[model samples]
Target: MEAERLRVRKDNSLLRKREPIPFTRESNYSTPVRPPDNDELPGEKKGLPWPVLLFLVTLVVPWILPIGPLRLSAYRIVLVVMVLPCLFMWLTGKVGRIRLTDIVVLSFCVWVFLSLIMVNGLSSSIEPSGIMFIETFGSYLLARCYIRGPDDFYNTVRALFLTNLFLFPFSLIEFVLGYNILHDMFSAILPTFNYPPMAARLGLSRVQSVFDHPILFGIFTGSTLALVHLVLGHGDNIARRFTRTAIVGTLAMMSLSGGPIQALAAQVFIIAWDSALKFLKSRWQIFLSLLALATIATEILAKRSLLEIMIATFTFDPLSYWFRRLIWSYGWASVLNHPFFGVGLERWERPDWMPPSIDNIWLYYAVHHGLPAAGLLLLAVAFAIWAACSAKALDSRLCAYRMGFIATLMAFFLTGWTVHYWGAAHCLFLFLMGSGAWMLERKANTGIELKTDTIKRIPSSHQRPSPHRNAFTRRILSETKLQISRKELPVLNPKGKVADLLP
Candidate 1:
């Protein structure tokens, strides 16, 4: 028994006090180190500086650039080239993973395709452009997938607000300077007039800002301005808040596309929307400011003989009051004539006979796609809204985007009564709303909220063993390398240490 115990002690000593192996250049093949924290590395964070910058820049180009035959509209062109290619890449898995929102949007687009195919069979002019609308929406849905988290979302919202901020200065300048700037700016490219009478006559010509037309400008800016106020609220600083309030309010007002009465009323509605959305303390402040704006607008309109101004400004025909009603009647008649698979997208407009009289968007849908198409479209819209409202309430950044998107839609809904600008921006906003919905659904599925920063813990593979950093691991790897160089591992001495083995 004593001999066996001595033998065991000797074996334990051999194991505990193994001699160190001599170092070589090859000894550098060491164990890999891992970071202690599970947080995602900075390199992994998504950076979209260029795309976001270009996107924001595109939104305001309409106001700053000269409009003519040759000057390319950046806003329209980006949608075709940048948006389409990116979308295709996403669908094919060449780009990042497409989110659930993208799938939903694509499904809806497929529905549009099937419907449009039927439209084309029925009416030849209902060409592929109608289908392309769904395609555009799909692109936006995919574009948003690149947005990784809350910071990305906040960046987008900031870009949106800053882009829209240009409206304040542009409209204000137009309102104060009247026709002088407009005539001078357009004179080089546009047909020069002797006196530029149209400019002076129109009194700021309802300056469309960056948008293509006055009415579109009014609606777009009005909606966004209202949305900003709604999200930001009237905070502590009275001066800054009121200044923004005045600028946006004035822009909406000076946009005389609504003439005097409608302009005043739209501003009131904008204020009311903002007031309704504000916190209790700020709510009263907004309400009082809104009342002041109303009083001022009313006084101005009364003095200017607003009703006469409106009559004169809007008088596009001999029996002006009846003309819109007459056109709408014709529009309804057209819808009745082609109820199912209505007039094709290209077929609906005839600039020669009359300047595309189907101004009402709801009616326009009915006229273009029939009751089934219109009904399906409305149902999709209703679902999107319900989804947005029912989903988790967004943070301030997301709130701005959501409110901006919805407000823009509402503006379109109202503007459809008079004009049609729902081609690109309309689809963009829809896709964004859908994407937002998808984000919420994803959050729910993960059983996590946006604010959480927990990193996903991927299990290490069998081939990649658990990171044990014992001397054997380093010794084995180094000896393996040296053996590859010298053609075999060095023989070990009876002491079981490579160092003890000499040549």
Candidate 2:
């Protein structure tokens, strides 16, 4: 017995630590055989695409670079430089099937040229119209071409968070010091326009960071709050998600701009509504019904327009609300006079002392470009949101992405009513709309079928029992890089077979 015990210890090695040899597939098929990670999947073989990274970096960088008489903005330069390649990709159907957004956006660009030509003759028109096209179509093209899938979409959300994370400290410093160090530093180095100290709002200096204006900075950073909080951190740790979101929200707040704060409020309201009544299946319909009732109640009780109340109540101050009311009243008049093709960049006649800057984006486009341009732009934004919502998600992560995408776009949509986006902000908005349109294209893809042996051969330890509706099936679909739907997964995993195959 002693001899046998010694032999067992020596040979079988009960006391010895054994290293686990991971399972490997015998088949030569290139399919990855691993369970899905909670956040990122196992099958992403490539790095984040370059076009996305380039544009995003360009976006946050300081805007103007003075060379001779012309002021060349970095975002526009990047957009213009990439136009040809993106256009070629579009022509080749590399950006997926062209949809209504694409058609309307392109048409809007054409109308801008027509309006400019009609007003400012073709010679002067070329420069302005061409720049507008580069800003609009170029940015859209890049997103359409490169941001093709859920992974790409999430990467974008992650990038936005990181970029803003980098900006967080600078924004705080700007607010506390009552000076924009980066803006001043960049001006010294580049011989750009030296902006005077902006007036304090809410007893703190408005933080512009590297953006052209504080409002722009706020809106741009606010754009990422919903996306980073909900989408990128969907399957991540709860504490970490809130921390990240708080950082982003604080960064946005440095600007003290009501437009972006309103945008953030809109997202929070939507998120709160969604969370509070998540148990109910038709929560959205109920919310809409409630909103309609509230609107009707306000209209009857307040003896004022809902629009007026919303604008006045949501602003940082009453004066801002009043100014915006004046803007709308006159901007609408300008639109009415030149309905089809509005005055092309010509100053719309207002009171002599009123500010020349148009604060509203929809009104800006309608007043300068035309109502058709504004209508098309509005249509494009609506379609982008709807397509993302309507397209099915492959898994929880993707569902979170759809949620974030909608929220971010909604923020932009709401923000546009009070603030005009130019330079980087404008491009980012168009790029986002273009990026989410791929979800519509995704719906057209047919699901791939996996042979039953693929699952059967996977060892029981590696396979988790997922029942009829399986997260594992979604994982498998992702692992194989296929677009297989949840409905068809039950065919392979029968009620009895799943347990029988386990051992």
Candidate 3:
């Protein structure tokens, strides 16, 4: 008996690759992306995505080499290599239409360059700013390019889960021993940053595993908990979901950081809230409204600002929260002083007793670069989240997937207030945020209908090609007076005729 081969009748956006069946073009012709030869490439590209590659590089290879004023890390090396291709993908519209977030991120990069140049000499600042460009925009674009849809998002989350699962035992051993074997082993043979081991809190020592710090290790592993349960957990047995969650959560707890705990608590709270209010379609809106109202109420009623109160409430240590409050006050004051271009790498003026380290990533950008630079980055994130929230998913799977991505991001938004992400964690955060780019483009309906041969035509892929590569698609859309998707589309039925491809 022969095995039955399943063929996809209609194209799905979630399908990793649905190469447009080639059509004859009387005008400028274009080729498909990386045309498969010798039948090696099949339904989907099986290798890890570039973003996952970055993720793995961060986890596996923390090798750092001192380069002049900066220390080079493995993930940054990957970004430096990937930035050009990433830019090419964005410009060619391979990912999707450019959203406000895309424009904001680009503007943020330029703003960072200008801020750096103003504070330091152009020669001195250009390299660091360019490095920032690679770290922020490059990582963002890489996620956008590879994680195209819900399926990719699920796979990415699965990869994270499995990786964390593998690291679980090691993290446990590291916690018990008060030493990170992986970090110790890596530092032995490779160039690694020296971070003194954190003090043991509550009889257990911090477990950093392979990352630079305990908080980093904790947050990186913990943030994926929501992504796992919400995306990959759907339609699966509760046992499996619990197992995966337990693995990730326990590993995160091994680091024994308050930020991870708070993030996990937030994830659980959202999950429970959704479960309780699943009947209401407007539940999320209600939650957001209440949250907003609470913020205003807190601002008016509480002695501390809402941010300060939230940080204090969420933090495990009251002392840490107080320290951060001081940082916030002093930090914003300095940001006000250098409102245009900030103090650059140079330390901001403060009372001699206050430690030099800025714990908040949001505040770090403002203090080190400028308020505008930080604002642009914040706006970009907000826009990305809003884009995801506003768009309609084509299916329930996509809906759940969006929830997972958003939940993880929410965790990061809160976690970032207490701890500043640096090195691999920083790159990972941007990459994860950028992975939601596809959500920005998805819609429940294309609003396209086909009645007969005279029906409108739209591109299947989301690439809005240039004149030469996709001239045929452009001409067809122009003639038919139809909207185009993000991918490059072709006129399947030339001579003003198209078979019904839309449902």
The candidate that wins on TM-score is 2
Superior by lDDT: candidate 2 or candidate 3: 2
Of 1 and 2, which scores higher on lDDT?
2
Task: Write the residue-wise lDDT of candidate 1 on 421-448 in tens digits.
Answer: 4533454445445444433432321110
- For all predicted structures, in order, the TM-scores are 0.55, 0.82, 0.78
Pairing residues by index, what is the TM-score of model 3?
0.78
Name the lDDT of candidate 1. Answer: 0.48
lDDT of 2 by residue, 9-92 (tens): 553442233432222343211333332332246125445688678888878767587656557787777787789998898888
Best by lDDT: 2
Could you give the candidate ranking by TM-score, starting with the highest? 2, 3, 1
Query: What tens digits encode model 3's per-residue C-alpha lDDT throughout 272-307?
Result: 888799899999899989999988888888855677
* Model 1 ranges off by over 4 Å: 1-49, 62-72, 84-131, 146-154, 176-204, 232-238, 259-321, 345-354, 393-405, 422-435, 438-503
**lDDT for every model?**
0.48, 0.75, 0.73
Candidate 3 lDDT at 47 equals 44
